[model samples]
Target: MSARLEVRLDDERKQRLEQLGEAEGVPISEVVRRLIDDAWEEVMRARRIAAVERMAQLEVEDPPDPETLSRELEETYGPGGLS
Candidate 1:
């Protein structure tokens, strides 16, 4: 099943949609559908980005200190430290 949306655009925007539809030889509804699809995709992409940023923040909240890691690396390898 599919849902429906009803939007009201200003005169200039409506005219632009109409012009684009005519130029592409498609109906205004198709233009609206494509625009809505693009908008929804952008919204979801932004949400995903926010989620990833939050996860990274949580993961790095108490990350390993740099000096300790360097010491461990030096112990594993000799003075050159794997070049």
Candidate 2:
């Protein structure tokens, strides 16, 4: 399915979009869509990084034994899996 979006861009931004589209041999709409997708990916990547940092900073009570974790890793994935 296809959808339509109507957007109003300032003259400068509209010109830039037109220039970019011309340089890429595509329509301004395509350029805008690509820019939107790129921006979305950047935002998602930042969120993922923040989540990982938060998880790293978390303190877990009653943490598992190192030996037990190693054994489990080895059993699940064979030798060198502990790394």
Per-model clash counts, in order, read 0, 0
| lDDT per residue as tens, model 2, 1-83 | 86999898899999999999999999998998899999999999999999999998989777579999888889999999946
- Model 1 lDDT tens row, 1-83: 76887889999999999999999999998998898899999999999999999988784556569987788778999676789
Q: What TM-score, computed on C-alpha atoms, does each candidate reach?
A: 0.59, 0.71
- Name the lDDT of candidate 2: 0.93
lDDT of each: 0.89, 0.93
**Which 10-residue window of candidate 2 scores lowest in summed lDDT?**
55-64
How much is the lDDT of residue 4 in candidate 2?
98
- Which pairs, if any, clash in model 2? none
Q: Which stretches of candidate 1 lie over 4 Å from their true place?
A: 1-7, 60-83
Segments of candidate 2 deviating more than 4 angstroms: 61-83
